[model samples]
Target: MSSHRRVWYPYVSPFDPCPPIKAKAYSTPPSLFLGYQPPNLEQFTPMEALKIGTLWKVFYDPWYSPYEVSTEEDQS
Candidate 1:
């Protein structure tokens, strides 16, 4: 079954993480997971990371986000 997170999804079928908020879905195309190079950690400034971390902390619920899980938005 298809899911609708937003009323108007900009990208057609095969898009993932549409920008500031990247919510992964099962419908995501296989190509996305095929050897995708993760963003470079070296370029991230401390402040940038801190901001993202704080946003992620609030975005996810503590119960769902176990202390061990990495901060990837598992929308699916």
Candidate 2:
């Protein structure tokens, strides 16, 4: 005797209507690890001077002040 039993399902005609399908909503998590923040290059030399202290004295240039602007007379 066979232990397995056969099952039968009803067959639908070609004229039968199709069943409706349900849609699902999905969301993605924020990428905190992959996000990047740019560095402030303008503050680089000042920050370095603070950290390095007196050692920055050797690299200082008295003639090259970034705050001073050259006028037309100065350029001439």
Candidate 3:
């Protein structure tokens, strides 16, 4: 018979007893590898502006400011 060694990995079963899992708080936000940048609004057309504005209204906080109320009326 040829001499050979066999290795075995410990098998974990569902019925096996496990220690209690502890939750850890993160000090910093997780990093995202995706190269994502916020959209630039200056290049948007009137139609595109309206569409984006409508969508933003549904959320509690919208990122972009489409309009600003002026205290003084237009003299023109």
Per-candidate clashes come to: 0, 0, 0
Alpha carbon lDDT at 33, candidate 2: 29
Give the Cα lDDT of each candidate.
0.36, 0.36, 0.33
Return the candidate ranking by lDDT, descending: 2, 1, 3
TM-score of 1: 0.19
Off by over 4 Å in 2: 19-76
Error of 2 at 10 (Å): 1.9
Q: Ten-residue segment with the worst summed lDDT in candidate 3?
A: 25-34
- C-alpha lDDT (0 to 100) for residue 2 of candidate 3: 15
Kindly report which residue pairs in candidate 3 clash with one another: none
Q: Please report the candidate that would top TM-score against the real structure.
A: 1
Candidate 3 per-residue lDDT over residues 13-65, each given as its tens digit: 66768953334222221113223534642344557657755332212122221
TM-score of 2: 0.17
lDDT of 3 at 30: 14
Off by over 4 Å in 3: 1-41, 54-76
Candidate 1, which segments miss by more than 4 Å at Cα? 1-35, 38-42, 54-76
Model 3 has an lDDT value of 0.33
Candidate 2, position 63, lDDT: 34
